[model samples]
Target: MDKFVTRAKKRVGGQSKKDECQRENLQKKPRSEVLKEEFQEDEEVNQFPQPVPWQKIEAEGLDCDYSLLFSKKEADTFFTQLEEEVVYFTGDQTKVQVYGKTYSVPRKQATYGDEGLMYSFSGVHLSARPWTATLEIIRDAVTKATGHTFNFVLINRYKDGHDHMGEHRDDERELDPSCPIASVSLGAARDFVFRHKDARSGQNRRQIDPVKLELAHGSLLLMNSPTNTYWYHSLPTRKKIKSPRINLTFRRIVKQRQRNAIKPS
Candidate 1:
C-alpha cells in the first residue's frame, strides 16, 4: 500500500511541476503586445477611401435635330481641323486576339477634352489635354442642351462607309454605370442597331430598330438608363455611303482607387 501511495504522489507532483512550467512560459511571453502590433499593421494597410456612387442626369423633350446645334461653316471647319490632328486607325487599336481570329478595331483619337480627366482601356491610359476655346464652347452648349456634365470626349473619325465598329457592349468595369453616355454624330448619317441580350421565340433574333436620322453635322443622341442596361448598340458597316462621318462620344469616368494611393514625393 505504501509503495502504491508513493508512486501516485510522484505522478501528481510531476504533473504539478509541468503545469507550473507552462504557466511561467506563458507569463514571460508578450502575447497581448504581439496581437496589438498585428492589429495596428492591418489597420494601416486597410486605410483607404471606398468608391461612391456616381451621379446621374436625364434630359427630356430635348432638341434632336442636327441643324439646330451648329452652322454649316463651323461644322466644316471643325471637321477639317479634326481630320488634320486626330489619329486614325484601320483596325482595333488594342488588337485583342480571340477564337483563332484577331478582332481588329479602327479607332482614332484627337483628345483635347477637359483638364484632370483621364481615359483608359485594357491597359492603355490617356491623360486629358487642356480644353481649347472651341472645345469649351461646344462642351458648354452640349451640356446645357443635354443636362449632363460630360468630362471627356472621345472623337471617332470614321473615314468612310467602310470604316465601322463591330458588335460590342460598352460596359467596362472602369466606367460608372450610373453616369449616362452621350454620343453626337456629325457628317454622314449611319444606321445604329440595338440588339436585345435576351430574345423571345418567333421574334427576330436581333432587333434592328434603325435610327435613320441624317446625323447631319451636329445631331446629338443621348443614351441613358434602361437603354444602356438592356441594349447593345453599334454602328454597322455600310457600303453605299461616300462621305466620312465624325462621331464624338462623351464619357464620364470614375476615379480609380489605385490612382488615389500614390504619394506625391
Candidate 2:
C-alpha cells in the first residue's frame, strides 16, 4: 500500500510540473500573439461552410429570414448522414392527441438536446436524447450562420409528399420567446404556409391571406419574434413529391427552473 501511494504521488507531481511548464510557455508569448494563437485554434475546430445572403419576408405579424446554408453537394452529404444517424420514435410514441383524439403523426419525429430538456405540445411530451455527432456539426453551422444559440433540436422526417404537418403555433410555455427558432432543411423542396390566428375558421374569421414559401434543400429559415405569437405554420401535403425531406428545428428552451418560476401556483 505504501509503495502504491508513493507511485501515485510521483505521478501527480509529474503531471503538475508538466502543466506548469505549459503555463510558463504560454505566458512567455506576447499577449497579442497568444490571442492570435487561441483564435486560430478555435477556427481550426469550428470550421463550417459559409452562409449565403439571406432574404427577409415580412408581413403584418410574421418575420422570416431565409438563406441557403449549404450547397447541393453539402446538402446531399448531410441528408444521407442524418438518415443513417437519427432514430425516430416508433409505434405509440409517434401518436399525438389533438382535441382529445389520438392520431399517429404523419411524419416521423425525434428530439435531441442538452440532458433533461423536454418539449411538449399536442398533449405529447418529447424528452431529448443526447446530441449526436452529425447533429452537433449541423447545429454549429446553424449557429455560425444565424448568430443565435440553441440548446434543443426537434427533427421531423417526411418520407414523401403524403407526410405533412398541420398548422400550429410553437409558442409553448417552455420555449424562449426572445429567441428565434432556426429551421434547417435537407432534401426535397416543399411549400411552407403560415396562417394568421384570426384567419382560421370561426365566426370572427378575417380575410387575411395565408403566406407561402418554398423551402428548398439545405435551406435555413429563422422565424423571429412575434411571428409565433400571431401565426400558425404547416407543411401541407403534395401528392406528387416522391423524395424524402428532413427538417431540423433548432430552438432555445427555457430551463426547467425558469419554467417553474413562471408557472401559476
Candidate 3:
C-alpha cells in the first residue's frame, strides 16, 4: 500500500511540474500569438464593413450610394496598370457647344466599349474603341461587383483640379431609363457636386446648397433611377489640387438593331 501511494504521488507531482512548465512557456510567447490561439475562431474570421444606406438628395430626389469596391493594394495595382498599359487621350482644346456657343472642353476624355458602340455628350460624340485587356479586366470586376453588366465605359482624365466638367444631366436620348451608372475613381480625390435643376430656375429664388461628395481612390459611386433626370452633376475647378485623377463611368449602351430595308444613298 505504501509503494502504491508513493507511485501515485510521484505521478501527480510530475504532472503538476509538466503543467507548470507549459504555463511558463505559454507566458513567454508573444501576447498576440497567445490571444490569437485563445481566440482562434475570431482570428480566422474575416470582418468587412457593412454597406452604408443610400444617400438621398432631398433637393433633387436623387439617390446615390458609395462603396469601397477595391482595397488599397487592388487600387494601387489598377492605378499602376492604367498608367503603364492604357493609352489615355487628353481631350485638350476639344471644341464643344454650350448654350449654342462653341468652347473648348476643360479636360481630356475617351470612350471604350464593345465594338461599334457610340456615345455622345457635351456636344461630343465618341466612338467606342475595342476594349483593351486592362479595361476588360476592370469592366469584368465592375460587373461582378455591381451585379450589373455594362457594355461601355467613359474615361475622363482630369490632369489636375483645374480640369473641370460642367453641370449637366445625363438624360441623353440614348441612355436607357432603368440602367444604373457606376463611376469608379482612382488617384487624387475630387469633389463631385449635384444641384437640383429647379433651383436654378429664375422664378425659384430660394438658395439650395448642392450636395457634394469627395470621391476617394478605389471608391465607387453609383447613380441610378431618377438621379440623372432630376439633378445636374459637375466637377468644379479647384486650383490647389495638383495631382491627376482618372474616372471610369461604366454604362450600358442599348444596341441599335440593323434593319435590312433598302435605302437610297
Task: For each candidate, give its TM-score against the true structure.
Answer: 0.59, 0.80, 0.72
Off by over 4 Å in 1: 1-68, 87-101, 110-112, 122-129, 200-214, 257-265
lDDT of 3 by residue, 1-265 (tens): 0010001012333457767797798789754344334333342221222342334434447887787666666666567666654555545426676888888777777788888777765556677888765566567656655678988898888889899989888776666667789899998899999988777778765576779999988888889878888788999999999998889999887754111111223
- Report lDDT (CA) for all predictions: 0.55, 0.83, 0.70
Which window of 10 residues has the lowest lDDT sum in candidate 2?
1-10
| Top candidate by lDDT | 2
Q: 1-265, model 2: which lDDT tens digit per residue?
A: 0010011012333457777797799789644344334434564435554554889999999999999887786677678868877889987779998888999999999999999898887767788999876777678778888888999999999999999999999888888888999999999999999999999989999999999999999899999999999999999999999999999999999886335634342
Candidate 2 Cα misplacement greater than 4 A, ranges: 1-52, 257-265
lDDT of 1 at 94: 45
Per residue, candidate 1 scores C-alpha lDDT tens digits across 1-265 of 0010011012333457777786587568554333223333454322322221223322221112232354565456556645654554333444544555665556455455656666655444556666544454456556655557877777777777888876555665555567667776778878876554543235555443333333567556666665555556677888898888988777776667225432243
User: Looking at model 1, which ten-residue stretch has the lowest summed lDDT?
Assistant: 1-10
By TM-score, highest first, what's the ranking?
2, 3, 1
Given candidate 2, what's the lDDT at residue 7?
A: 11
Q: What TM-score does candidate 1 reach?
A: 0.59
Each prediction's Cα RMSD? 26.9, 12.3, 15.7
